[model samples]
Target chain A: MIPDDRKYTQEHEWVQVEGDAGVVGVTDHAASELGDIVYVDLPDVGAEFSAGDSVGSIESVKAVADLYIPVSGEIIEINEALDGDPALVNNSPMDDGWMFKVRLADPGELETLLDAAGYEDLLGK
Target chain B: MSDLKQTPLHQWHIDHGARMVEFAGFAMPVQYEGVLAEHATVRDAVGLFDITHMGEVFVEGPGAGAWLSGLITNSIIKGEPGKVTYTAMCNEQGGTLDDMLIYRLTEERWLVVMNASNHDKIVDWMQRHLPAEGVTMDDASDRTGLIAVQGPDSQDLVGRLEALAPHVAPIAELGFYTHIAVDGPGGEWIVSRTGYTGEHGYEIYLPAGAMLAAWEELLARGEDLGVRPIGLAARDTLRFEACYCLYGHELSEDWTPLEAGIGWAVKLKKKAGFIGRDALAAQKEAGIPRTLIGLEVEGGPIAREGCPVLAGDREVGHVTSGTFAPTLQKKLALALVEKDFAEADLMVEVRGKRLATRHRALPFLAARVKGDPRAERALS
Candidate 1:
């Protein structure tokens, strides 16, 4: 299910705004499409990236996909738990699977992202 | 999707919620549950696979054995009836055309099973080389269906078939690489004690029309036995772990059987000289230039197929197949590299970054295909 609290990208990533920071992770549809993620290459905390820059990668049993940053920000935290158990992405894509927390460069960028209804339309759900 | 071919069990796969993908021109199931879970099911318990896309060719007549012996790298004439010999067919240059299994039903009858992608090519090659007399070849691919039941509990799941018990040996008594043919109401069924997976398994070849019933029956009977439906994704991982050479990946026209690490299947001294015997002999005398070796990459990034293998900035070779081995819990890759750098310090270039890798043995995991039944029980 597409969560209403988070804004999503066409690349299948979602970001939930919390104060000045945004928690990012792939959507459930992306996790299911990936098919049993075995490894997640998380970006380093404090790493800076521009919008649409590849932050890291998600490696599944069959293939791999790059995780793109939706907006310019500096990484403040990464989920270290994924290093030991990446299947969490498939098990809890909307909650415990949060990949990284970024200090948002422009909160206004959140408005440009697709809301639940918009994302559902994009996915033709 | 309309252009792709479908197996007789295609609807069953769809009804069971399998994710389908295009493979070898056929619309096949890539996974049912998930690759990791399906892979684990095969390694730990049992799994069924609909491999109906694979090709089956029948050769009959008095000269069948001799004709086949001259075509394959391995000696088919030397193998007794009921035995399945794995061999490679090659061109005059010793480049592999396809790797397949030849089942000798009798002195004058043989059955060849080959890769689905190479079906047309292999059949064309065989037809061109058909002898003027004493041998007849028939391609039965479209009319045949294949089902593979693999894993530790495979024997128990397959042995429970009362229909098979009346026709063939008790599944437990069937020797490795052996098969028994039965004339059933549907058609002739050939149950072979052979499989691509390293686990104990069996491959049943029957009429295409009868596949759906068998598949449904197996699932119905295997529900309590922890048997799950496997797919192409897990099939690759399973065969990769077993160090089996996938045609396009490991065995190809670009790499000979010797360099591909299937030299055991290539018998240069067989009584009948094959198409590429001279070339393979010459290559062996000159020393193999490159060798297929297993590698374990450090870190999360996988060195996938086509990734360059470098030895201190010099390109050595490329990865043929790589994945996060579900059973070993490590990132592993099979690379075709210069024989000199096979054991040397190497790095695989993945996504513009070089990752350190260590040379590992051919199979990342020990194959338990033929061993004490107790050993399988111990693992389970």
Candidate 2:
């Protein structure tokens, strides 16, 4: 199910804004399609990225996909638990699987993100 | 997509929520539940595979052994009945046409199991040279269903098949590379103590009509042993860890068996005058220019197939089969490299960046082949 609260990207990442910081993670569909999450690669905290930049990557047994930053921001904190238990991304992509927290560089970039209905329409679901 | 083939267990896979993908013209399961979980299940316990997508061809005649000996690199004439020999069929230029397992069913009969993608190629290659008065080849792929039950506890699961209980002795005592014909729900099938994964396992080739029953029975009986259906994704990783060559990836028409690390299987001294004997023997005398070596990357970015292998500033080779091995927990790859550059301590270009790598030995993990003299006593 596409959650209504967060903004979604065509790349399948979900972003939720809390004050000036945004929490980011992949969508449920992305996690399901990748099959067992074997490894997750994230950039170091304090790293700045432009909107749609390849911030990191996630690898499963059969495939690998580059993780895109949904909006331009500077990474503040990353979920360190994922280093040992990458399966958390598959188990709870929307919540505990959140990859990192970033302080927004420009709140205007969120306007380009898709709403829940738009994301569902993009999936044709 | 319309011409894509479906195996007998196609619907069964879909019903189990398998994510399907087009592989060699068949809609096969890439993963089910998850690839990591399925891989771990096979490594630690037992797992089943629907390998009906593989091709099975039979040759039978008075001259079957002698005729096959001429077409393959292995000495098939010396292999007795019920024994299996892994060999590579090569072109006159010594490039591999396909690597297959040949089972001598009897003095006049033989079964050749080949990769699905090379089924037509192998058939045409054999037919062109088949002795007119002797050997006859028949394609049994459509009627055959191959199921691999692999892991340490696979033997116990096979013993519980009620319909197959009477034939338990062969299953219990079957040596590696040996097979036995058993009467079962499928009328009759060959149970071979052979597997692609490095684990101790059995591959059952039976009638497609009776595949479902066998699959269900294996799952039902293997429940306590944690037997689950494994997908192709894990199958590749498992075989990769074992350093098994995948046709299009590692073994190919452009590479010879000598360079692919199967030189031991090439019997050039045999007097049968095999297909590529002259070329392989000539290469042997001159020494193979390239050799296949295993590589382990430091971390994250995987070195996939076709990735260039670097020796300082010069690109010396390319990766063939690579993966993040589930059991070993390392990003490993098999690369065909210049003989001089195959030594330990190398690097690979992954995603435009060079990653530090080390040349590990083949079969990253110790193989648990049943009859290997050096194999540890434990089944795993």
Per-model TM values vs. the true structure: 0.97, 0.95
lDDT of candidate 1 over B105-216, digit per residue (tens): 9889999999999999999999999999999999999999999999888887886665575754555677888888887548899998888878888999999988888888
Cα misplacement distance, residue B228 of candidate 2 (Å) = 1.0
| Lowest-sum lDDT 10-residue window in model 2 chain B | B371-380
C-alpha positional error of residue B304 in candidate 1 after TM-score superposition, expressed in Å: 0.6
TM-score of chain A of each: 0.97, 0.97
lDDT of 2 by residue, B1-380 (tens): 55889988888999999888888888888888777788889888899999998999999999889889889998878778989999999999899999999999989999999999999899999989988887889999999999999888888888888866888887888899989886777677999999988888899999999998889989999899999999999999989888888999989888799999998889998886888889998988998999999888876578889999998888899999888888888888899999988884678997788899876877787777755423453211
Residue B81, model 1: Cα distance from true site in angstroms: 0.9
Candidate 2 off by > 4 Å: A44-47, B371-380
Native contacts recovered, each model: 0.89, 0.58
Computed on alpha carbons, the lDDT of every model, listed in order, comes to 0.90, 0.88
Which pairs of residues have clashing backbones in candidate 1?
none
DockQ comparisons of all candidates to the true complex: 0.87, 0.65
